[model samples]
Target chain A: MITLETIRTAHDRIRAHIHRTPILTNQTINELSGVHIFFKPENFQKIGAFKARGGLNAILQLSEQERYHGRTMGPVTTHSSGNHAQAVAFAARQVGIKAYIVMPRTAPQVKKDAVKGYGAEIIECEPTLEAREAGVREVIERTGAVLVHPFDDDRVIAGQATAAKELIEDADYDSFFDAILAPVGGGGLLSGTALSTHYLSPRTKVFAGEPEGAADAVLSFKSGKVEKAPYINSLADGLLTSLSERTLGYIREHVTDILTVSDAEISAAMRLVWERMKIVIEPSSAVPLAALFKNKAQFTGQKVGIILTGGNTDLGKLPF
Target chain B: MITLETIRTAHDRIRAHIHRTPILTNQTINELSGVHIFFKPENFQKIGAFKARGGLNAILQLSEQERYHGRTMGPVTTHSSGNHAQAVAFAARQVGIKAYIVMPRTAPQVKKDAVKGYGAEIIECEPTLEAREAGVREVIERTGAVLVHPFDDDRVIAGQATAAKELIEDADYDSFFDAILAPVGGGGLLSGTALSTHYLSPRTKVFAGEPEGAADAVLSFKSGKVEKAPYINSLADGLLTSLSERTLGYIREHVTDILTVSDAEISAAMRLVWERMKIVIEPSSAVPLAALFKNKAQFTGQKVGIILTGGNTDLGKLPF
Candidate 1:
């Protein structure tokens, strides 16, 4: 498990680079659910997602010798659906390194354009996890480039923890929140947030929100062991990752519960956010809110802090 | 003319009640136009439009006696397409007053539902200014309700100026900016921004961006007289207004340039913003960018500020 001290250090390092994203207070939501809901809107970050925090922090933490001597080679390589690819590409550009992104051919054009705009090279692959993984491995082997796994690295986890650190520091809602809910995919973000909350604000319980179709984390939490889904089939593409070993350990210790919601629920939550908050957020970011609404009985009369993890949704293709 | 001091006072009165919306740095636009472009994203404001600033400030300024007395006489009335109507409805509901909104029958159902969600009574009229004005007057007189003009009012103009105030306060780009560009409708917002730039940073020039199809503001500015269009037939519904007397006076003195963009250019700008920034914005908010892009020569190598006044666009029905 990642230590709280490491998470704290990561928070301090990334504080200047990442946006202390705002928490939106919804009166209408409170009135309807009888739950005090505060949305940690990470959608407003520099790269339009929280992935920037982890990607940038990890890249920045490389030793001076490692960086200058090309110990990590000339490029950064990653396999991502969208947001993570953009984050890696953006961070690589910032640090004067080339980025080679392996994306499924079916990925949205907008995401592709964004990655390209950040001066990254794109390698298109078949729309399959195996294909993406194989493609990324080939690139890493051929170019001798550093592989920035989207959410599985310890440094990445620590960097993602900074979001929770800022949220806790900016808002005096320590005693107000009964639990903190975050979307769980490969689990770097969830692990980092859980780690930060366990030490910084131990009173608040941590809950992992997973889509029903991609509920590997839920099964893992239930079985008291790590689990993996061979392939994910859900609208929340960002949450398709099977649990990593480090994230599994973090969840076993810090996460109190794992909740699941259907794709329909995720879509509905996305619409609610757009219509009510006027902020554009991707379907993956809406999973936590879906979990909150699905399990309202558990959260009623309690303050629930939900991390809206990303906003990479293409407005043109809204399910509505 | 409403002095900049009065606008600053309005800003203070409503600062806590409204959101300090973010300024979007347009990197893609800057590269495309050879201009440093910064967009004031007022679409993220409370009530999902810039109108909230004015509505909240106007309501906050009312005396305690007015709060109680106003409620007894029934709802406040306003004639608007959606944005201002929703703003007034939200403000009225927040202050415990009933609201009656007169909207065109052709108004989007989503907007009507938003107003209704705020507990406002909606009165529909033919999709014409004459019909809307007549219908709203009847409702106002019958209910003894106060009328909140969408624009063309001192309070609204003062409230609108806060966007410019915030832009200057948050970004110290005075050295880079040659001009601030804003869309003009009834001229309330443009006039307010002009006054703000004129007094706060006299070195920066102010430009009004108007729709080519609805070029009343541009004609008025060029003629050095208040001009009214026989009818508004532009896609930018928010900029379809005849300039008010006070607004005209301020624009005549403080505004340096008035430029127009075709509706096609506005549509392209909206698409670019959605595709690039991943933020949904309405047609009026895209006008300033359209003007800058259409007349690239005017803005090349110059720092420009464009107020993206609202983001109330329905992603489902994008013009593209």
Candidate 2:
């Protein structure tokens, strides 16, 4: 079970390897929202996402006995077409271990190139959840590599919580935030953020922001059980995954509420950040801001903290 | 006359009003160039440019006697269609003074709207230098307002110098930088930067980065006299202006050399910043990086400082 202490330990483990990303604030955004908003820009984090922390923490926690059975050690394996692929590759390389990534054939060339840049071997599979799982299994069977589930693992969840731990402790705000918001992408960031805020600032409520098109977290929260969307289609590509049982348990226990925002709202918020803050943020990162903007009354005259999940964007295919 | 002391005073005066912009570094970029690079991102400033410092300093420096002749105080007038217009407007509003901006009708609507949003009245003119001057003269005649020249004024130069002052002091480097680079337009930023480096770190050299299409500053530096470009056409719209006499004097004395980069190089640098640093910067702001990349031999193992002049970009009209 992951607790506040586990998160703290993970924070200590990954402190030296990751960057302490800046807390950005904009006067215009503050005025418009009628609230003091502090943004934890993880876009500036190493590997261009908060995934770096989790990946590094998980890799470092692996015991030598578990890594190697005989004189030879096995490679780490994962199935991802996004930032996690690069993160795992980077973490494995840092720990002197080879990484084997299973990616969909339909994934963008940029994503493939980024994972390859981190010195990871890629194995392409059909664009389906079962196909990805089969590809990972095949790689593990051939190379005896261990599979690192993206957001479902306890170690990864604890590591992801460090971002919020830093946000709560490092941000130069008075006392604590009234509310902390994070995008719900397979419930890694939101669950981690909820746990951190629960431990660090008990008075602060944790909120989950999900794209309306892929509102699996919202449905699960309302239904009081693990739920999946029938059809997922959002510009926020990072947020299309359904929450795992482990992540859903944390969300049910800690998250105050789940908010949903449209793709248009997401794009508008992204544009505002680009224009006003002069920082590049992916569509997924903008969901929290869009949620806050849409539901302004709940946070009026309050202090809010937002986690900007990542900045790995395809410039040639900008939505704006 | 502008001096280091004047720049220090400007820094003190505008310290609270403007952002103490952060210095960013990228490991990939450092490895690529074989130099430690510090980027002072003024694109994240109040008016999205370093002009905010100059405009605010100039307005705040104006005495009541100079501002008010009879019972009525005169408005601040300037002829600009870019960041300066917004800067003057924002600064005037902050100081509780009226601003009269004479902009060419051919200027982008977005630029005009931004000035108006800052509570400045816009006076439209024909798309010519002579027409712009006439429009400003007319505004001065009608309101008896003080003319705030964008770059020629000593106060503006002093204010612009504060950016370099903060860069030299705030950046996390062991010793002083080997060189400081800034894009030269009317030579306001370059001159100010040169003066600041000259006073703070005497060992550091100041270099001006200019677009080859608008290579007047390079010609002027080489010829040891003020020179003008026969024609100006560059993607960096902020770099089309020629250096004024007041700015030219500082450049001739303090600047080590002037380097020119092509428009393609500027775009590449801008794209790199967007991809690597996750920061938005204008084409002109990218000129310094392009120049440094081209002239890498001069700064192979040295520390370098680059000023990102502005981030006010039109999303719909992206060059990429």
Candidate 3:
């Protein structure tokens, strides 16, 4: 039910809380790919990801009844071991609210520390989606907190759309872009991008870049139904999640196509971005670039926009 | 004499050719150091350094008589194993001129390849400053090319000043910076930065950041004369060169002080920039930040500008 107006409202509401990340262009990359590319570096955003927009928008939109119970502000709860956990925690603290983040025990220490650093109370759970969800439910039941599902919520999707909205509006690309590409995870960024592009620049096609190892979005697009990968083995750890039905609905209606890229291609693209652009981008962010380069024939001689999802990576564990 | 007018002219001449590199800020670094830090990321510039501005300015400012010898365009020659070689080559190629770069045979293959990639012919020399100068002299004598000294030349220094000019003009700081710090090698960036700050933001004090292992700049500043390190041992390879007399003259006139940081501190600062700023900066660029952090007491509660000199690094040979 998220519309252009909803996304616009979210953008306006969260505008002050987030960074209007820079859109950078590289001549070498443009010449190599045979396409003019505008890269929206969300890694520079607050909390180091596009998720900040969604989390902030979602938190700021809470009604008085939802935010407060008596004199105390009610807690917000989420189950994520990824950027969303830190995003929600950061946004919650910004609004003077407590956050209960349910994370798996197997999650990286850096992510856990980041979430904790934001003044969020962590509820450790077993390394499974069901266990994580149950942990979140338990925290909510005990604390009377509202649950903000990462990608399933309409408000979150509307928040994510602001990244694309800003990209389309701010980039001084001559006229409109021929296409826009975003990596597909739980489909939050991809679906949000699809909606924004559909409303803002109807002529521009929205493409979803998914990892070949976790090709649920691609499979779902082909089968015309929600699908899950049997075994995910991509180096893009942020893209291992299956798409929610809500995200799939938006993708089916608005996204032009779902493209897949291998882990090797993702690593190569990541290295190129680091070496050429002098910007740090995670493997997930490189997926879109990998797909764009792999399908250069389809996008030759056209202006393209690529959303670099995030830049949270272990420098010690670089893929290269 | 290099004046503010000279720097301004360089800015105007090279404005169209080089990137107006972005000035970025980080809340984490500000909080950590107790100083408001404005980072002028010249690392993102063409040739991945501020040298591009100087190289482009020097080449473009060449007189028709100097640029051409009858029907044939005169070649430009320089001896550099660092970012300057690529900068001169890139600038030369942009103006339809040939570049002769002299480098030690022991220079990184990647550095040599980058110069060659820009259509510049590389003249391999022995790994000594004497050999480098002799090789450059040979190239100039053979081809009747003009020698563009990296930092000592007034035109190149003026070009380097443009980075600080843009930084002073573009940064959204509420007021002029209290102080500015730039890493010193042959003193091109530091002296240029001092001149720019002296002219533009007269209230701002300029400091030179140098590696402890290559503390010639500090020694020279104290002695009021040019000084050279007995043996350079810092990880910041770019700051190993001794300051030229032309550059030292400016440093003594305008620079507030010369501060030195250790290689360990440089590595730590570089890691922090990568992790927090989400930008790739070479070890040389980290010297300023390390110096700033070490002497936080001096700059406490003050607004400081740190020029990140370059981002050209061998990815496989990361210090971290």
Candidate 4:
């Protein structure tokens, strides 16, 4: 469970290691959504995503006994085909540790190259959830490396909370934003965001945007239990994972609601941000804005904050 | 004709109306090019380009007699199919005036839409330069709108000079950059940049990048007169214009050298900025960076500044 002190402590631990990414605003974006929107762009973060925060926090906290084998790090490991892979790899190199990233053979080349570029040893596995976990387990058994779960960890959740903490601190003068939104994938960002909002600014409500193709979080929110999505097909490729019990518990308590948007809506919003804001954001980063525009009545004339998650997108495969 | 005082006065005249856009740096870019690079990102400026500075400066300086035919502004006219058209249109809107933009019929739709979105009346003509000039002259004859030449006039050059002025002021403290680069089209930005560097950071050498496909500026730089390119073709659509007599005069006096790059090199460098820096930049903006990388030995171990011109790219037609 994350308390206010937990996030503050995590921020202090990782503040020097990661970027306190800037909050950007645009008049055209505000007029279109009918809200005074403040965008917390994590796309410009280390490794080009907010994952850098949680990854560094998790790694930096390793015990002297647990982290070191003489001079070199005992090695940390993670199985991811996403920004988290690059995050772990980059964080390890920053603190003089070795990282072993287990990615599926079918995973994107851009992500793979980025992880390797950060000097992480990549172990390619079969493109299946079981294969990925097995690969991580194999690496742990052989190399005596610690497994750093991508989302379902107390340390990572606490670390992710710092993004919202920074956002609230920067955007507030007298009162906080009227509402705040973040995309829900494995629910790590949403849960962390919710906890930070509930602790730092009680009046502000927390909401999440999930892709219609990956509707597990929305179902879990309604059913009061972790649930699998009915289907999986979306341009927002980063939000395709199921939520954990740890993440769902926090979401059910602090989050107001979960909204889903179609791929058409997501791509449209993404293009607008690129064309109007002149910032490169991936499809997943557009989900919250898409939800806001789809249901604009709820936030008309109010100050709303949306976390733009990352910018690690493959430009070769853009959906106009 | 454009002195340091002229640029300073222009900056004062249009500071409130324009965004003093940010200067961004990326570690990967610096390492690859082996030079400490400071990027003046005018891509995030109003109208999504640096053209906004000159356009606003020109429009804001319109006289009480020349600018007023009754109540509404007498209207401003320009013949451009690129970012300049949108700049004039956006600047006109800011000052509560009408803008008549004469654009070639073959101009990209994305640019035409942006100009129209800013309340400019678009007058389309044949794709030839003569036809475009006739269209602008016709607009002047009918509505009496003052002609704001894209880059030929001294006022426009002085306005464009502010981008480099701000770049030098922000990036230098004890010593100036070793060299600075800007893409040369009609030479407005390059000539203005040379003048500002000459006045403020006299130690900094002024260089320019031009596409070999549209390689008129290099010839003009050597010939001491405006000369046309052998052929007109490039992915950097914004840098296809030939230099004017006024721009050529300034270039001969202050500019150090002009470098030409192939379209392939420009597109590759453009992708690198988009991928590594996570910022949206058009093909023309990447020319200077491309030239820097192509001739890296000259800039090794030195601090260099490059002005990233704009970000008005069409997502549907991105190369690559």
Off by over 4 Å in 3: A63-72, A172-175, B64-72, B171-175
Q: Pick the candidate with the highest TM-score.
A: 4
Clashing pairs in 4: none
Looking at candidate 4 chain B, the ten consecutive residues that score lowest on lDDT are B63-72
lDDT tens per residue, model 3, B1-320: 98888998888888888888877899999999999999999889999999999999898988445546555568999999999999999999988999999999999998999999999999999999899999999998899988888898989999999988888888665337999899999999888999999888888999988999998988888898888885799999999999988999999999999988988999999999999999999999999999999999999999899999999998888999
Tens digits of lDDT, candidate 1, B1-320:
57777888898888877888877774666788899988888877877778898887666665344656873434678999868998889888877888889999999888999899889999999998899999988997899787888777888888888888888777775534688999999888898898888778788899888988888888888787888775668889888878877788889999998888888999999877765565667899999999888889977898788898887866677777
Q: What is the TM-score of candidate 4?
A: 0.97
Task: Pick out the ten consecutive residues of candidate 2 chain B with the lowest summed lDDT.
Answer: B63-72
Stretches of candidate 4 exceeding 4 Å from the true structure: A63-73, B63-73, B172-174
The docking quality of candidate 1, as DockQ, is 0.43
| DockQ-superior candidate, 2 or 3 | 2
Please give the CA lDDT of all the candidate structures: 0.83, 0.90, 0.91, 0.91
- Higher-scoring candidate on lDDT, 2 or 3: 3
Provide TM-scores for the models: 0.90, 0.97, 0.97, 0.97
Across residues B196-216, which tens digit of lDDT does each residue of candidate 4 receive? 999999989999999999999
Which model, 1 or 4, shows the larger DockQ?
4
Report the poorest 10 consecutive residues by lDDT, candidate 4 chain A. A63-72
lDDT of 4 by residue, A1-320 (tens): 68899899889989987878888999999988889999999999989888998898888877444545554458999999998999899888887889999999999888888899999999999999999999999999999998888899988989888999999999756356989999999988898999999998888989999999999999999999999999999999889999999999999999999999999999999999998998889999999999999999999999988999999899999988
